[model samples]
Structures are given as C-alpha cells and as structure tokens.
Target chain A: MQVHIPLKKVVDNSYDITIDTLPKMNFDTKVAVVTNQTVSKLHLDYLLSKISAKELHVITLQDGEEYKNQVSIDAILESLFENRFNRKSMLIAFGGGVIGDMTGYAASIFQRGIDFIQIPTTLLSQVDASVGGKTGMNNKYGKNLVGAFHQPKAVYIDPYFLTTLPQREFSAGVAEIVKMAVTFNKEFFTFLESADLNNPKVLQEVIKQAVQTKASVVAEDEKEKGIRAALNYGHTFGHVIENETQYKKFLHGEAVAIGMVMANEMAVKMNLMSEKEALRVKSLLEKYNLPVSYVIEDVRKFYETFFLDKKSSDSAITFVLPLGIGDFVITDKIDNGTIMCVLNKFGKN
Target chain B: MQVHIPLKKVVDNSYDITIDTLPKMNFDTKVAVVTNQTVSKLHLDYLLSKISAKELHVITLQDGEEYKNQVSIDAILESLFENRFNRKSMLIAFGGGVIGDMTGYAASIFQRGIDFIQIPTTLLSQVDASVGGKTGMNNKYGKNLVGAFHQPKAVYIDPYFLTTLPQREFSAGVAEIVKMAVTFNKEFFTFLESADLNNPKVLQEVIKQAVQTKASVVAEDEKEKGIRAALNYGHTFGHVIENETQYKKFLHGEAVAIGMVMANEMAVKMNLMSEKEALRVKSLLEKYNLPVSYVIEDVRKFYETFFLDKKSSDSAITFVLPLGIGDFVITDKIDNGTIMCVLNKFGKN
Candidate 1:
C-alpha cells in the first residue's frame, strides 16, 4: 500500500519589524519574557509595563555570548514547563541577539514550537538579527551548530534601547549595517561613509535602510538556499575568526568587519574589487571605530578553520565576496593558492 | 521603519509512505543511518544492502525510550559535526519510533534544519509516528516535551522487519492499529475485529488502512490545531499512565491500549458510548493481547498527572472520549467529580 501524506498549505510566517517604539502588548494567553540579567536590570520594567497577559512571567538568564548553549536553552524550557505554559503561551525575547536566538530556539522546541516576539535591545540585533528567522545556540563544534529556522511572530525594534548600548557594542552593530550597504545598496553605502549616526534621526534612517535591505533578501530566500547565502557576505571568514579567538576577542559584527576586509583582499586579487574600492569599505568601517584587521597566528591553521564552519559543505568552502560594493559573488572556485596567498597577508610577523 | 518578512509560499512537505517492499535507496549526499543496537543487529545488513551514498555513516544510540533525551540528541549532533556533514547531508531513521523521533529532531536542529527519511521497522511507527511530523525527545516533564514538527522527506515501510519482532512489541504495535480504527473508521474496526493479521497479506492491508487513516488526518491538520488533536484520543490518558509507571513497566502502545479503555469508561459515564460499545473496544484490544487495565495508587494524584501532559494547556485538562466507535468528543467540560469517580474506580482498594 502506498500512502501519500498530502501536505499542501500556504505558510505565512511573515511578520512586521517595527522600529522606534515598543507598542503595548496584550495577550490572552500566558507570556514569558525570556531575557538576560543585564537586559532585565536595564530595561525589564520598561518592557513589563507595556505587556498585559493572563499570566506574565520573567525568566532571567545570565548575560553573555558564552551563556548561549544547551544549558541555557534547558533553563528557559524548564521555566516554561514549571509555569505550565502550553503551545498557546508565548515567549518574548528581550535582550541582544543571544537572548533572541535562545528564546526563539526554546520557543521552537517547547511543545514543538510556539509564538515568540523579538524585542532586540542591541544595535547589531536591531538591524541584522531582527530581520532573519535564524534562531540557534552555540556548541563546541561551532556557533549556531545546533539550531532551527523558527521565525518570530513579530519584531519590535526600539531606538530607545540603543541609548544604553556601550560604544564598542555600538560600533560592532555599525559593522553589520555597513555589511548590508556593501552587499546590496551602493547609495546606502555612499551615504554611510559620511552619515552622522550620532544624530538619532540619521541613526534611525540607517537602521531602516539596513533592515529593509535584509528584509528584502530574507523575503527572497527564508531558508538561505540561494540568495540568502549572500547575506553571509563576510560571515565565512568571520565565523572562523570568532572560533580562533574563542568568540571573546571580538563581537560578531566586529569580527565580520575584519572578515569583510579579508574578503575584499581576495576580491581585489580576483579583480572583482580594486584596491581603492576595498580601501573605501575599510574607511567606512574605521569611521565607526570597527576593527578592520587581525593577525592570523598561523595562515595554514586559519585557512583550515574555514572548513569547520557550517557553511562549508564537503571539501569546498563557499566564499561570499564583493563584486565591487553594492553587489557580490558567491563562489567555491577559489583555489588553495589564492586562499593561502590572501590569508598569508594577515599572517603573524 | 516597519518591514514585512514577506513569507507567503505554499510548503509541500508531503511524501509517499510505501508499504510491503522497501525500495532501493540512493543518495548523492552524505547519509547517516540512525538506528539502535537491537534494530541494527537484526536488520542493519538488510538495510545496508539497499542503499548507496556519497559517504555513509551509522550512528547507534542506546535502544530504549530512556535514551530519548537531550544527551542522545546531542550525541547524534556531535557525530554529524564530527563527520563534517553539512546542510546537504541527509539522515535516514532506521529503527522504531524512538530512533525516528531522535533522528528527525537532530536533523531539525543540526545547522538549523536538514532533510531526513523514515524507514520505520515497528508497526507503531509505520502506522502512526511515520505519518505525522511530530519529532521530539522526552524530558523530565513528560514524553515529547521538547521537540519540533519536522516532516520527513519520505517514508519506507517493509513488512519483512516485523518477522523478527518480539510478540510483546508486535502486540504493542497492534494497539496503535486499533487506536486508528476506533477513532475514525468503524469499517476498519470491524475488519480488525475479525481479521487474522497472522497472515502477512492481511497485516500489510491493516497497516495500509491505519496509515491511510493517519495520512488523511495529518494532511488536514499537521500542527494539531483542530482535527489533528483528535488523533491523541487515547494518548491523553496513555501519557499519564506512562508517566506514572516511569515508562518502565509497559511499552508506549501497551500504555495507550490501557488508556483507551480508561477513556471508554469515561465515555460510557458521559453517555457518549454504551457499556456494550466500551466492552467491544476492550475485547478488540484483548484479541491482540494488549493490556487494557491499570491500577492507580492515588486517585487524586493520578488525576493530577494529567496536567503534566503537554496536551493540557494552562490549567484545563482536555479529555478525548469516544462518542460511539467511529467518533469522539474532545472537551474540557468533564467535571473533576466525574474524573475522580472514574479514576477512583481503578484505584487500589
């Protein structure tokens, strides 16, 4: 007997990413705001004041990228179970990308997924993580090695949260914003070169531009099958960098800033980007105080680290490089000679 | 700025459930056959004789329900990362329901979702677990408390595997078959009552009928929002029984068999089912040597266990009782007095 499971339905996981203000949230079902101690202490009252639920709970986790692991995921789930939360109950992610990722992962696995809303408080998360449905936690193998593509029901990005962000963290976020401009919009990149983001109005516009650029890319490929891989513009190099540095030396966007620089050198070798064009991207990154350089302790070891990344399938490492700003090319054709030559440039003295 | 994710696409996760003969499987990508010590010893050679892959790996977990936890899930994931299996890699679940659930879960979380196929050897998995996309592992809270709904790429069912199955396990599988007939198909119930499934041909047909019943139910409701939940008919009671016994005394199907009888008793009290009808269902279960009774130690404590089930949302315990042989009534309306009375009847005197 041949039984065909006829599953044909239109799935609409689409949600709005609202910037500037956090609206009053009212839920008939139980809601848990999964946050970190750092974010909760700073903004928990502000977040709690806006929500009214049949039963509301605050689950505070230890703050740090290191805390993003299975243990924390288990804690969030344990809390939900303890509170007798069900599939109808919701989770609110109320921190940086770490909280958003962990909350979304917990929501995804708790009773086979429930609704989760993102209230990303960090600059990097607001512009980059907010738009993508990628939710995950880090394991010993690599970052986001274990995760799911569980989308948020909605996203609330308030510029007000950025007021409390540290300067280095602020620059780390600008790196991601620059990534969006360098990959998709030339005019946006040009504007960013001189944009006074200190002016809150300009910052809001920059966030909008970055988010809109990401929103469109994610809209095309939600699962990162095709065009979505382009969004990993500097992430291939960045992930390896993070892994080498044990995710402590740099914030995600800061590593990506340097990763973008490393990728540009390769692009320059390929003649897709000239030295001047690469220098322009570096200048824009420097303007935001983002680190644009790193010394690879061992070029061979650094090159080998690329294979450990989840993006590298089989023996080939797919590199997303600049086709001269505002456009890009994803290729696996770069030989070891080219890779080693480019990597050796960043080698130790 | 407000950005819509724009995710409106028809997702077709539908796949064929081929019964009787296993097809010659081939994969262009890396393939890992996730099975157990028992199944692999009995049938791994037979399964390996049918497939070819770019790179093949066999991951064996401890062969019991107790092994179904985060540790096992992590083990499966760790093997995958160590093997350098990327997004293009596929997992083949080659044991019973436990292996299927864990493998599917590992695939769901590994690098945020990958493809998997189900080769269900047990009658229970072939008829029930293989059809629905409910993939998860049990936790301290209850069965399948942490999981996701990841539909398999395809499912292959071969009746040959059952020849080596233990009689108790075979009877347990038959319990699920009876569950399918009781909830939705009176004709199938009549067929099951008189049919001698000892004849391989008849058994294949019965499995077909049960799989078909489940296929249609799952097709209409994948996420268990409305009609799909009705399939949890006996499971609501069964889960509590399984929890009470710590999943040690009886197999899942045996517990569900007893649970159905408990539900029938409740239905008889509610006037939804006659005493004769309830007996008929019990007799059918007895024909397969399925357990149809349990001794509750504490009526109130036993009743409290119902809340621990993942199905019970908030404080209300939803009960699914038979409304005659081919129909059911899903309601949270049954009073605690009625529940206690029914539970006390099964209590130790």
Candidate 2:
C-alpha cells in the first residue's frame, strides 16, 4: 500500500532575510549559535544584537574545510547536550557552508533531531547551502558521507554580514551563483555576466533569483530522485577536486568554479555544448574573478575519484552536462575516450 | 518562500512479510546481518541460508538491553567500514527491538545514511519497532533520547523465529500487541479478551492487526507530529520506569506491561475508563504472565520522573490514557493532584 509521510511545516519557528539588515528572530527555546572562530570574531556581535532568543550560547570551532569532520561535529553536539538543550531547542548555523553543513547535521542527529535556523553569513552558503535541506558532517572517507536530508526550520540570509567578508570569500559565493545560472537559468547567467556583483542592489537581485531557482527545483525534486540532480551541474567534478585536495587547497566555491569549467569542456567534447557557449561560461566565471583553471596531475586518478562520490553508482559516474546554457542532461553513458580527452585538457594545464 | 522537501519513495527496494514463509528478495550488494548473540545462535543459519548477497558478514552483539549504547552501535559501523561496504551495501536488523533500533540508527548515520532492512525476530519489534522509522541509542539521560526517524528500506517478518523464543520474551511481545489493540482497535481488544493468544493461528492474526494498525498511524504521522503520539499510550510512564530502574530490571515490553496497568488506574480515576474495563485489561495481561505490578519508593520522585520524559514539555507531563477498552487520549492536561494520587497509590501497594 502506498503511504504518505506528512511533510511537517515547522511554523512558530521561522525567520526572513532582507539584503542588508541583520535577521531578528526571537526564540524562547535554548539557542546555540554555531560559528567558526573567523566568523565569530568578525560579525558575532552584529548577529547577537539582532537575535532575540531568551538564552543564547555561542559555540565556535576552528575555521576551514579541514574542520568539517566528525570530531568538530561531536564537539558541537556535546556542547548542546552539556547545556541541557531539549528537543524544543534551536541551533543557529552562523558561518559559511562548512559551518552550516556541520551545524545542520549536528542538529539533525542531536536528540534525533531538533529545530534549527540557518543564519548563513557566507556568500557561498547564502546562495547554495541555505536552500538545500542537505545537512551532514564530513568524515575521512568523504564529504557529507555521514549526514541526513534534514531541512532547516528557516533560513536567515543577511547580506549585511557580507560587508566584512574577505574578497576571496566574496568571489567564492559568486562561483556557486554562476553554477546555478549555468544549468538552470541562462537569462540569469547573462545578467551575471554584466552586473557588478559588488553592488548591494545587484547582489540582492542575484540572491533572490538564485534562491527562487533553487527553491522551485527543490520543490520539484527534494531528494535528488530525478530533476534535482541537474542542480549538481558543477558538483560532480567539484567533489572530486575537493576530495583530491583533501578539501584543503581551495575554497569550496573556488573548487566548484574550476569544476564548472571542466564540465563545460567535457560538454563541448561530447558535442552536448557548443564551444562558444562553453567559452562564454569560462569568461563569465573569470569576470567574477573565480578560478576557471585547475591542474589535474593524473587523468585516471582524477576519473577514479568520481566513484567515491555519494551520487555515483557502483561502476558508473553520473555527470550533469550542460546541453548549452539553460538546458542540461544527466548521464553515465559518456564513453571513456571522451572523458580521458577532457581530463587531458585539465591535466596539469 | 516555503520549500517542501519531496520525500523519496524507495521503489527499487521494499518487501512483504508473511507469517509462514521467509522473504525471497536477493541482494547482490554486500550485506551485514546485525543480530544479537542469542538470536544468532538460534536463527542465524536459517537467515544466512536464504540470503544470496555477494558477501554476507555476521556481526553479533551481546544480547541485552544494557548493550544498546553508542559503543555497540559504533562497533557495527566500524565493522561495516572495515569490510569496505559502500553506499549500495545493506544492513539487516535481525533481532528484537533493541537490535533493530540500534542497527537502524547506525545505518541512518553511516556514510550519511545507508539502506537498512528489518527482520524482526521478536514479537514486540514486529508489532512496533519494525513499522516506525525511529532509530536510536540510549544514554544516561533516557531511553531513545538520541535517534532519528529513518524508515527501513523494507521489513520482513517470519513467525517461525518465534518458535524458539522463551516464554518471558514471548510474553513481552504480547504486551506491545495488547497496547496496540487497547489504544486503537476496539474490535481487536474484544477479540483478545477471549482469544487464545498462545495459539499459533491467533498469534498470527494478532500480529497482522497490530502491524497494520501501527503502519496506518505511522503513515499518517511519520514524524509523530500529531496523531502518532497516541501510539505511546503506555510509553510515557513506561520510559520513566525503565529510566529509574536503569533499563536493567525489566525488558522494555515488561516495563510497558506495568505501565499500562498504571495508565489504566489513572484512566479509572479520571472516569475515562470503567473499573470493569480496566480489570479486563489486567486479566488479559495476567493470562500471558506479564508482570503488571511494581513498587514505588517515593511518590514525588516518581512524579518528577514524568517531567524528564522526552514527550513532556515545560507545560505539563503528557500522559496517554485509555478512553475506553480500545480508544486512548494523549494529553498533558491531567492535573498534578490526580497524578500524585496515582503515584501515592503505587507507594501504598
């Protein structure tokens, strides 16, 4: 018999984000603000001034992709338990993608699951991680290998925090925005090509467009059961790059920037994308000062990394290739020779 | 914008359980059969003979409630990782409720979440745990205080395993069956009054009724958002009892047996159920030799334990009381004076 597991709309606990204003959500339950030392020192006061929680605690972990492991996640869970946070408690993910991912995961599993709100302070997180319900901590085996598809109660995206963001971090966020446009929104891609991303008004419009595009796609396929996989246009290659570097060498968005370029090259080789469109994508990425090149040492070694990705099946690597700018195809049927040629181009170039 | 996460229906997976025969679905992926030493000694051979997985590994845990902790759960996960089990690999929960709950939890968090199937060998699990998506490991705080609502890929029940179950364990399963009937099915309750529970034919009918009843309730309220909390008819009191005793003195189902009696007494005090109906419920439990009595040390201490229960919020302790023979009510409105009277009565006894 077909059964429907009712989707719970978590009301009474919600928040909204205006572009330049800090989010203000008053929570009566025990609230823990999870952030990295970098974000905490930079904008913790700005966030605290806006929050109206009854009793708020700040938990700061070491910053960076290397700190996204289970040890860091365990530390976060232990702190919450030590504070006697109950199921009614809430966690505020107050950093970049790494902090948001780990906090969302810790919330998802702590006391089974608890209420959590995302106060994404990173541009990358603001554009990508905030909308997806994917929450998990990284392990030695892989990134987000130990996690749950737990959605946040709400997301508070205040671009006001971005004023203090490092320039490199700013570029990283745009890399993700560029990815959203490549596979799903060609018109948005063109807008990004000419817009001054540093301008607050243009950034606000970009954030809204990216969120709406992601929200519509997520509503259609939340679990990546079908159409949602296309949203992973740059992620398949990005994950391989992240894994090869042990998630240490580049910012997550920066790695994805390189991944998107590599994907475009593969699409052109497969005749799925015209060379002109592929070059147009690289130029757009470069316009935002995002990396459009990477040095791949061994093509086979790079190809082997794809299988380790959670999205890959046992023997086949799923690729999300752009047919051009707005349209795309998901397939594992690409021949080995074509893949090798694409990898050769990125190999130590 | 409100984004709804579309729940994935695992179509490639799923199986039906029958009373007389074992399931026939075969697996080419690696399989870990998680069972207790007791169940393994008795039924492992039979289960192993039926599975045609590429490689089948047996990881036996010590058989007891005390063994259901993070240490045991981690052992299972470590073994899976050691065996190089990938995302496609599956874990089969092959014992009673404790084994099933821990196994399901390990699978849920391992590599984010992997697939798990339930082959409930105990009656209590077949009727209750196997149907719900709840998976957890207990700690000093409380029973099931840490867990997730991760449903199994499939559940398989073969009553033949029950043939070797001891009378104590067998009666424990009956306690859950009785709980199910009393809370939801009046006709089923009437059937139980005179039904020969030990008879194989009668037991099969009872198991099917309990499973189907619980399944319907879970389908409607997967996350225990509303109607599903009613399923915890005797659990609120039962959990406190189990906690106070350190989960050592009584089997989960056994504590629940005494808890049901306590709930009935409260119901009679509130005039929700007649004394005669309560007596019938007691007599049914007595026929199976399930323990329906406990000594209370202090009335206030016992009452305080209710508040610590995960279900209880700051407002009041939620009690699931019987409305009549087969109907029940889940509420926190039962006054302190009434609860005190019940606890005081326990001390007197």
Task: Chain A only: list TM-scores of all candidates.
Answer: 0.99, 0.93
lDDT of 1 by residue, A3-49 (tens): 88989899988889999689999999999999999889899999999
What are the candidates' individual DockQ scores?
A: 0.88, 0.31
Model 2 agreement with the true structure over B130-184: per-residue lDDT tens digits? 8778999887667777789788877777888889989898899989989988889
- Look at candidate 2 and tell me the lDDT of residue B125: 90
Candidate 2: residue A111 Cα off by (Å): 4.1
In candidate 1, position B146 carries an lDDT of 93
- The per-candidate count of clashes, in order, stands at 0, 5
Task: Compose the digit string of candidate 1's lDDT tens values, residues B1-349.
Answer: 6877789889888898899688898899999999999999999999999999999999999999999998899889988988999999999999899999999999999999999999999988988887788899999999999999999999999999999999999999999888888889998999988999899999999999999999999999889888788788889889999888888999999999999999999999999999999999999999888999899988788888888798997768898888899888889889889998889889998
How well does candidate 2 score on lDDT at residue A176?
A: 84
Show where candidate 2 strays beyond 4 Å. Answer: A1-20, A28-30, A79-84, A274-276, A297-301, A344-349, B1-17, B27-32, B53-59, B75-90, B110-115, B274-276, B297-303, B347-349
Best TM-score among the predictions, by candidate number? 1
Look at candidate 1 and give me any clashing residue pairs: none
Weakest 10 consecutive residues, lDDT, candidate 2 chain A? A6-15
